[model samples]
Target: MSLPKPVMRGLLAKRLRFHLPIAFGLAITTALVFKYTVTEPRKKAYADFYKQYDAVKEFNAMREAGVFESVRPSGE
Candidate 1:
């Protein structure tokens, strides 16, 4: 049985008042979980990788392999 109209009941505001907090809570929880599981580990992996990374050594290796344009090939 249908009861009343919005003029009598104010159903929209009541529904939103109840559901909005729940929706916001769920969104925040999902974001936090995703950050911990995905973003945090990705940041940690990048930090660990960069911690052991050596740029000058890589450049020297590339120079030895004649990978740079400024380093001409031996056949040329």
Candidate 2:
């Protein structure tokens, strides 16, 4: 037996309604997984670098070596 046009339309609408959210949720989950996988290593590397790096020590060493003295402004 053939379904009426209205019945087919209703069925199509119901199917779309049921599957749309699942598709949306899967897309979001996949994007988040890829994002974290790509960024986690970079973030960890930055954290590790910062943990061992000290700006003050580097600045003081540069100053003691007269690196900044030549570049210093006369007014300063």
Candidate 3:
């Protein structure tokens, strides 16, 4: 048996008010969380690793170019 039109409409309206905000809030919260949690950390880590790698490369170059050879200790 089908619900009467007014009853169906009222039921639908009630359900929408209850569920819609929850769904929309969850979607927005998820998006913000993903951006801050996943994207920001990954970007920071990449930048940090890049900087560290560059520093290491520069250090190696300096060592090879005799800039810090005196500090290298003769035993190695």
Candidate 4:
């Protein structure tokens, strides 16, 4: 025996309302997992690179190249 039309529609609506949010939540959780897993190592590598970089050496090299004159102010 077939369900009445209104009953069928009600079942469909309830099923969609229940499952849609679950599906959406799972999709968001999965995307977050993949994003953090893929990017964490790259972020750590960048942090290490910056930690080792010598800003003073880079500044002196630029000065030697005449990119800047004396470190003293031009107003001096």
Candidate closest to the true structure, highest lDDT: 1
What are the clash counts of all predictions, listed in order? 0, 0, 0, 0
- What is candidate 3's lDDT per residue for 1-76, written digit by digit as tens? 9976666647888999999999999999999999999999999999988875877668777776678846563346
Q: Model 2, range 1-76, lDDT digits (tens) per residue?
A: 9966665647878999999999999999999998899888889999999999999888877776668856553345
Give the CA lDDT, 0 to 100, for residue 9 in model 1.
69
Candidate 3, residue 40: lDDT: 99
Off by over 4 Å in 2: 1-12, 60-76
RMSD of each: 3.4, 5.4, 8.9, 5.3
Q: Model 3 misses residue 35 by how many Å? A: 1.9
Q: Considering summed lDDT, which 10 consecutive residues are worst modelled in model 3?
A: 67-76
Q: How many pairs of residues in model 2 come into backbone collision?
A: 0
The lDDT of each candidate is 0.90, 0.83, 0.83, 0.82
**Candidate 2 — what's its lDDT?**
0.83
Best by TM-score: 1
What is residue 11's positional error in candidate 3, in angstroms?
A: 2.4
Tens-digit lDDT track of model 4 for 1-76: 9966665647878999999999999999999998799888789899999998999888877766668755743345
Query: Between prediction 1 and prediction 2, which has the larger TM-score?
Result: 1
Superposition error at 15 for model 4 (Å): 3.7
lDDT of 4: 0.82
Against the hidden reference, what TM-scores do the models get?
0.73, 0.49, 0.51, 0.49
Model 1 misplaced regions, further than 4 Å: 1-9, 71-76
